[model samples]
Target chain A: MPGPTALNFSEATSHDMFAQRLPQSKDDSLPQVLAAAVTHLHALIRELRPTQADWRKVIEFLTDVGHASDERRQEWVLLSDLLGASALVEEINSRRPKTATPNTVRGPFFRADVPQLPLGGNISLDGIGETLDVFGRVQDLDGDPIANAEIITWQANAQGFYENQQPDLQPEFNLRGCFRTDTDGRFHYRTIKPCGYGVPDDGPVGKLLRQAGYPLCRPAHLHFMIKAPEFETVTTHIYDGSDPHLAEDAIFAVKPELVRTFEQQGKGWLLKLTFIMVRARRGAGT
Target chain B: MPGPTALNFSEATSHDMFAQRLPQSKDDSLPQVLAAAVTHLHALIRELRPTQADWRKVIEFLTDVGHASDERRQEWVLLSDLLGASALVEEINSRRPKTATPNTVRGPFFRADVPQLPLGGNISLDGIGETLDVFGRVQDLDGDPIANAEIITWQANAQGFYENQQPDLQPEFNLRGCFRTDTDGRFHYRTIKPCGYGVPDDGPVGKLLRQAGYPLCRPAHLHFMIKAPEFETVTTHIYDGSDPHLAEDAIFAVKPELVRTFEQQGKGWLLKLTFIMVRARRGAGT
Candidate 1:
């Protein structure tokens, strides 16, 4: 016969007992984060009181999202963006001073190896859209120029597709380039005006959005990543103020300070703006 | 040039804007559940203020979990189980009267097609470990016998491995059987005493548990699913009260009412228990 045992179960204290048995980690924050996650997750379950079938659906949906992701595609990131989680994380992490440029999501289309271009060089090799000349200066919050700052930028074509997305139709590096600031912290580049585009909607994330009756189009915007020694690198975007989707960007990444007007220049257009950067804190290594 | 546009971005209202823009569904509960999920998720991000790198790790972990899951194995379910989510969901959804048999997680090992056995029939085809005889009565709250109630049960072998997990070593349908209650609400089955076993630990969920220093073994228990017309089907376990892991079942499924002692019976062991079922609500379709 087996030994005598205790049978002192209490339903009222079950949740607390479960919480107390959570795994402890040597990394302090891991336990704390996991505890918070468990607390909120249990609360959500209690509130929703989901049936077994409902719980199964959630697991299946998550599995589908995972299966749809690969090196070239990130369905999970898209889900996060659609849920406004990415934007919320950016806001929480990038609480910069009013004078400094704000940070935004880097998005999934960024490629690190685009060819560098000389000032005034054109990035729109295919030249499919109306010509756009963009001039910008990289400077500190005090308005002092930061020389030799690296400015990398990319955007969709007139058809609302990135070059990588349409490799067969668009030229290599079409509307994508890297440039260095002049001694005066000034840089200029020529490109085609981008158009609003739909986020990839063939995956499970898209299915959820469609079921929720949410729009899939993001407002037209130009992506930029600016970096310099001893300064905080900013990954941001410049949205065309006139884009119809500005008020309802699918990813909720629109910020008024990041929007600009494209003034008519002859038969083309001209966009002029300044990027204000913040210096890194002393003894804080990036 | 494009027309003038509004750039009235308000970071303070961004979360509310995103929430308001959440996809509405004809299915009211979908919207409600998603809204709650988003609210809690956003609060988690705000509280943790995770760095981009930290966020990336979470995505990567979830992706790994998804990748590891397939038709035969469910890493996501294992994750939910390890985090006490499945138990919480079960508790919330299975709030029955005190006299009714409580529900526990069905777990991932249930097979729908086990062979039915006659009374006193042995389910341990290989006849491994100490012989155990389990006789139980099925009845309603009024203490009346429930004739013909179907009782299906399965358990791990002495080596703590299911037949499916070790197909080559164990006979097909080893330690699994289905039986019906006699006119007196009595049913009996013979089986080998089960040992506590580790969950599938080769997957990402196991990695997380190991990192957190949590035990991977569930207490030794025999699974049962009982059903009859006009009654609620219950999925539960009869845990060995003498098992060392009873106090810390990895899945947090143990309840005092569900634990029992195995008494010495001649050369073998015998366990006696009664299962009380609750009637289903009228017109509540199964």
Candidate 2:
């Protein structure tokens, strides 16, 4: 709060009057709190000291981040993921035991309800690309089988764009699949290897990233937001080992432990994977 | 960073994911940083547990805040002031500020260049409301006038409208004036008692304030941004002692020492005020 003054003076004196953040104060109301926050966050961004032109570019990118959204897809999600915000959120909220599987951003390309399939069923749209087999198993934290658990999977064509984002580059429904773990808690899919690709960069998010000296490409990966009754939903990504962004994925979704190598088998490649879900306790909210 | 396997079940058994200001850490870039911030701010606002209808009202008000901006005014600024951001910025950037003449928000209603007037000349033009004669002397922090200081002032007329905001309600140049301090650091103006008033509530900022249960009115005040050769220019508001919003002028510009009372003096109420400025030194950028 500014105090009043009656100190009538004529000479001018020099003073530097800029503080970056507000001193900690008790919560007064929600709006005051949020406004202080907007100010703080804005101040932090300013400290980045982006060039004026870069600032304009960032604004343009944000405009696209919003423009890129639609009923079935949300580019802002990718924008957030690339900026690492979505992952940051997952990390901050993952207070469960360390052994529990960690969460990741639910990538921009996801649908509300994926069709469930039995074990051994193939979901490849045209079985295009070099023949590849993906086999994965689901288990409880104790390594017990989660018999018949569902495994919903989706990926971009060999070109790296999601089926929804690039319908022209790749056939609709190409490389997208859903399967269920067998009694042994194992599931498999047959499709081509997904290539690393560029995210929509013509939009606001892309513009911002480009202005910030960031890349618009993400490593080749698969999307999985797993949910089972009595267990928490897990949103995550699986990265291909050889992708260039293996080191600097725009979405920051790559983890050393999550990287998997493709194995040569006969005329095709075989990839083996596993997923561990936290089992729900009795009477826990589903 | 988000690790592989987001199925952290151990902690899930005890806590729900919707707890507090959690961070998403995979991306360290600015966009991701802001995204998490939006989530956190949004969550904090939600925790206030406002009603759905109230939320709708806020959305509408914020839209209006944006709509309120046009060729001359910036409603976002008004909202910022109401949210206390303007004052916070001044507090953070205050350079070696003296306690007597603290800093404040340069409200949403300021013009770049004001007409320069001779010392002791009255700048007020309305001549309608209570005949009040505002007499003031300007001095340096050491109590000596360096002379030729610019004192530009603008305020709402008796009807609580700046000349620029309400052309029909206020005559052109009504209650808006600029004067230079004389060799003795003396200045004066005659005008009506500007009233306290509520901010336009149909804009986005107003909606947010209403939803947060914050007041919309700012206390009665006379704005002054003073500058002189070799002196530091200071922009501030001298709030009226009797205004209802004195304790919480939307912009937090109310200073205890700055508030002054008024009393009838012959044909009008006389006000005697003083402003002390710091001398600008060599190489001191104004």
Candidate 3:
């Protein structure tokens, strides 16, 4: 609420006070901070020498990024990430052990209220694709079992389309569901193999990457957002090693450790991996 | 420019066809790059799992950044830096030089077509503000005088307002001018001392910095974009010490080495510094 108040108020008044004039008293923190930006900005403008047309092109591109979003897609997150701002902020804010699983961009496909299901529950809708059984144990930073941990997953179908993408083709919640770990911190799920897919590039991310000669494919993987009380939620992806583009996914996400190799046995491959979560440091008054 | 046509048209279509669709045989390099971006994008979306509102926020922020730009400002560049995309891309593209000056965001306050004044030109307008003599030598990587180099300089008045900021109080280009190096690659200018100033806090960088608890003030500095016929143009700032808020300038631009201590004499102070520029490798095109 106070955001709009401060932002909108400054424009109307103090036309020359900011960027040129200093605050009178000891409380000139905001003005001082802004001066550096403006000064640097002034120099940058000289070097860049962008014309009005160049400015409009960027504006139109940004507007198109907005117009490209829909109920099933999010172009903004992709743009933030390709631009490197999202990943940089994440690195600045979320510093954890490199040995511990690294966190990348949290994409725009998760639902807030995924229906909670019991441990050992099968989340696959009608279990149609490859019959793979997945099991994992959850632990805290100190390798302690984090009982009652919640594991949520959502992925595209065999053709790499989510249920939201094709309501008529896929069942509601197909390859999407939530499961809480048991007392031993172990959980299991039965689902089909997820195929790798590409982002919605009919928009700005596509435009930029296309110009810069970047690829637009992600290897097959299952999405996971694991959470428990007092611990940091690890939103991650487990990529299948066999996917064609596992190494060169455009987002630069393919941690050698995150890619798990699957062994095909009888009818399907058995997927088993242990998950380790870290306890979050509480801020002041948290 | 081939900028717009560089983005492929065919792959910039629907989601199902766009994902994982790398250009293989006939799609040309553009399609290959665009398809790659979409592929990773598809995964990024699955991973970040952003809501529609979250997606809209990013688009709106970028739009506002572009919309905030004017002749005197370019918020889009600042936005790119704030997002960490620029630095990352630069790091990826440019070779890291430990001794060489680091490249940073070229802010948006520089004006084009600064008059080419001769060596030892006095750029101070009407003897306004505090009197100071600024001198500098431009040298090659091996300490050779970069003769005939062009050095453009500008700064705010004692009140911290540039000539452009206040047309009434200051003359046109009051504190801004350009000077060329002598055959020995040296130049000098007489100007008034500029105090620290704030950027327009009403802009996007200001709003975001305040929200992030970043102080908005910057130390005083002169703008410099040095260029020689055969050398890579270097756009940088020469910082002034003895200014308040030097340590916590919100833009992260306080380089201790770049600061020149002013020596007080009878009436004015003299600040001397040297610009060590790396020469462009022979035949290296800009």
Best of the candidates, DockQ: 1
In Å, what is the interface RMSD of model 3?
15.5
The candidate with the higher lDDT, 1 or 3, is 1
lDDT of each: 0.83, 0.61, 0.62
Worst 10 residues of 2 chain B by lDDT: B12-21
lDDT, candidate 3, at A223: 82
Q: Where does the lowest 10-residue lDDT sum fall in candidate 3 chain B?
A: B1-10
Give lDDT tens digits, candidate 3, residues A73-158. 66766776554334433443345675566555566667666787776667777667787788888986677788988888887777
Residue B66: error of model 1 in Å? 1.5
Q: Give candidate 3's whole-model lDDT.
A: 0.62
Every prediction: chain A TM-score: 0.90, 0.78, 0.80
Error of 1 at B200 (Å): 3.6
Q: Rank all candidate structures by their lDDT, best first, as comma-separated numbers.
A: 1, 3, 2
Deviation (Å) of A228 in candidate 2:
4.5
- What RMSD does each model have against the real structure? 4.0, 9.5, 15.6
Candidate 1 clashing pairs? none
Regions of candidate 1 where Cα sits further than 4 Å from its true position: A1-15, A22-27, A111-127, A142-148, A163-190, A265-268, A282-285, B1-15, B23-27, B113-128, B143-150, B163-190, B264-268
Clash count for each candidate, listed in order shown: 0, 56, 45
TM-score of 2: 0.58
Model 1: residue B222 alpha-carbon error in angstroms: 1.6
